[model samples]
Target: MAMRASMHLVKSRTLLACAKEESEYRVRHPENSSPNARVLVLGGTGRVGGSTAIALSNLRPDLRIIVAGRNREKGASMVATLGGNSQFAEVDIENVKSLEAALKDVDLVVHAAGPFQQAERCTVLEAAIQTKTAYVDVCDDTTYSWRAKSFKDRAVAANIPAITTGGIYPGVSNVMAAELVRASRSESNGEPERLRFYYYTAGTGGAGPTILATSFLLLGEDVAAYNKGEMIKLKPYSGMLNIDFGKGIGKRDVYLLNLPEVRSVHEVLGIPTVSARFGTAPFFWNWGMEAMTSLLPAEFLRDRSKVQELVQLFDPVVRAVDRIAGERVSMRVDLECSDGRNAVGIFSHRRLSVCVGNATAAFALAVLEGSTQPGVWFPEEPEGIAIEAREVLLKRAAQGTINFVMNRPPWMVESDPKELGLGIYV
Candidate 1:
């Protein structure tokens, strides 16, 4: 009885401390407390966008949500799922007038319309800047993300903040890397040497055709990775490594891809060697993806229209497989220091569809709360982007994660951690 009482007291104190911290955060950023903020989620008809809308509605029931897309039926369906505080907007991303009209009244816009690869213009972002509305995007393409960053000056001039690559893998993953690097430096762990990102997801990740198009597009690009302060390009999907993603997801084979977070992390976090790789389940899918790289011409793969056709052809099959494969997703970030010290961060969730929405909504909430400065920023940028609100952002993003750990030794988070005699694990 006495021990139980003591444990309850400890738990109460911990909750009090957390409440105090949250109070301080709210005091520091008053904009987040706005009661009547309106948010527009472009591409809300799609899987990623619809999920994001649901997540935002769940997180802040009072906020008004507008589901914007070209398909009125789909948009209306999504809005209906979001309850009374939500409505549908018929807007096409390619139509500047449509985008501008949609942005006029929204406090923030989430550009979840993607297959950002090979996109030549930042239409929605430009519209956001023109309307002086804050923005966030779930962009996974390297070229598009950098192009968004090029608008830093303009965004600052417009006095609106923007974040690119703010989705699950690139978004939350980038923040995770930053936190790991920050801890290493602050703790004098060692000079951070190598940073590797490994990701595993089940078939289609329950994200639908958009993700399929993105994958096909990525196959056309060469993989860019940093090695000892030098950049090198390798064939996409060539390098494969077996990574353990802890419980609920055992070891899986991941492959190299031209993901944006690698460059952003290497540059923003100043890591010497950085690379990102991803793989999906139902083993045949991995075989098929590698086969596509070899079978299809690079030009064919790079063509957006061609990729869409391919997505159309494969969508049914992928969706069928997704049912059996499930939508589990896991990301493991490993950082090795010069002095043989290693730190790791892992995020695993049962449903990629749900977790991605939460991850994106976390970034959206951060921007609404005044956590970002008036400029286009990457997730890893420390000054005024995500550093200040990282803890809260991570907490929100990790809401449904089955396994989430940070700043721990590799062994602690590994599925099959090796014991190296005595009490040491490696």
Candidate 2:
């Protein structure tokens, strides 16, 4: 259902509020656009998709971008906004023929259009499979991500490379944890062990509804974590955590939740233990848990009238809230070796777009550059994939350097175990 106009106006102001609190953009590296690699971004007119397109255009001038979406005008507008070497085509994601036609001769496909809850029954994934084309998506939907994983066996057989979870929370969060595992294993003389992953968002406003939807779908679902070398459930919100987000985000409370990364971090990376949590600016973070806890049980959350009513009410209020505060998103991953040694790493980014866009674009660039395989892969560990992958993303998000921490906390030069574990839970 279309959002009420009042809701839209409120959303707009809320976004403005988020922008004000966003950190300054770090200086970007010049695009390494190679003329040989061409990319087709489905849903390129949307938020994550659009940001991914812009980041890619800016990062790789040699890349020719073909944008396909339902609306030609909007697609063309996005293309125009992107400047040279970009074009748009109207295609229905639901139609197999339309999708196949768009996929013909495309080097890589970035599926950015979603709320895949509705789109999954369509032809997007199947078209990529049939075309034998590489695919990537900024999908935040957990069910879709799991279902996409089912494509791994077939994709490998077809020699088609595909990647999902190409957005901030799952995309970078997955890779960042993978990198920590790889780094820790290497440091520990080749032995990998337990893993813990933390995810937090402070200035992330545009994605509030998306995050809320994700939480609802996973609620009451058994969240799996490794226990003593065995898989186990960690009830969502069962483990309250207090995570220190450094100066930009400050100290905030988080909850133990069954999250997407738990699946990949353990199954793909072979880490014995893996957990993920949500982090936001203090108030937004707290409000999310409370609001989701309340709204998820009823059909009202899906009700257009109720959604708009709340959006209209919260939108204006969110603006005033932003003026009083700021925004941020940070992630931390720690690896524990069976031998008792440990290594910790943290990545923090201010703008939601940069954090996810840089990661998605870099993965696309890797495919274009032939640094990644044609088969499906989760960035479980940095060692197996292109060595250039992390560097490419880190370089693009150069304006905001991703902080890497070891034994010390990024927010504090020293460590306090209680501060780290206490605040985020309750």
Candidate 3:
């Protein structure tokens, strides 16, 4: 009887899973689809995607961006908003056929979709491989970005670039640390030391379904870290710290998240210790997420419906604040050695989307300009890439919109042969 029951449960789950998959497919792909040669913005109808379109468009008008999404009208409207060089198309990530059709002929794919926390069986990286387009996704979900390594070899085999977490914490923060450590090594007999990265997305603006989805994905993965060469499962909101956001943003409280780039960076650089912490704007907001995580166990973290409800509740409020508060995303990365040596860098910007979008633009532009060494790379790898990326970011930040700043601790502020300087790259 027990065996029969187990079999029935499996069959029931399989059917339900199939049904959900079918539903996602229908939503992702709906009829008309044509890809462009220059660029493809997967979730162009959404906030980050639209901003990315604007940024890229401003940078280079000759490059065409196919604004893609399920809603043709919305995509077309966004494209129209960008003028003649931009065009709109219908394509979906959930639907594999649609994704293939959407990616056809596109040189690059920027996936800006969301709620990847519920994703189990399907992935955008798979589609990128099948489509043979260089891939970049603004996925803030740490674990999903980490798990994406499964497709790395395939990406290499296809001779296409697949980069994830192209957003604030993982994207810019990762590069920041990479640049610092690389510089330290360059100065100090070629041996890199440990690094710590802190990202605080303050002012509580621009929170969306995608961000919530990222949260859920991290929750499901139970966020992990490499400490003393052992993998330790981290509870959400467990690591808490008060970080100085610098100047106007002031001191903000942040929580330790299972941001995978920390560990991934360590792996890439062979650095022994690397950890990251994240927090939001306002003390109340920081405490609120912590409070929620404490009350809800991992089981509740896996509840999709709950995640959706939170998205609905937070999305509008966050967007409104993003527009009004001029809320900024700030990151501070510190590098240290065993003998009380440290260097710190800070990047602050008014918009999270612009911050990340610009970071992607910088790296992508570098790749286009042949500014980077060829081969698989994290933004921070290849020694000098992070330094180059930071210089680009800081230069653009000075022009306004995206603000990237670097600072060293007071003791290490002065120029010294013993310590690394700005580590700026051309």
**How many backbone overlaps does candidate 2 show?**
22
Every model: Cα RMSD to truth: 9.2, 10.9, 13.3
Best by TM-score: 1
Clashing pairs for predicted structure model 3, backbone only: 239-256
Q: Where is the poorest 10-residue window by lDDT in model 1?
A: 7-16
Every model's TM-score: 0.90, 0.78, 0.79
Q: Which model, 1 or 2, shows the larger lDDT?
A: 1
Which sections of candidate 3 miss by over 4 Å? 1-37, 189-192, 216-221, 314-325, 370-377, 383-403, 410-426
lDDT, model 3, position 274: 65
Cα lDDT tens digits for candidate 2, 195-215: 676767653444444434444
lDDT of 3: 0.61
Which window of 10 residues has the lowest lDDT sum in candidate 3?
Answer: 417-426
For residue 273, model 3's alpha carbon misses the true position, in angstroms, by 2.3
**Top candidate by lDDT:** 1
Query: How much lDDT does each candidate structure score?
Result: 0.84, 0.61, 0.61
Model 2 RMSD in Å is 10.9
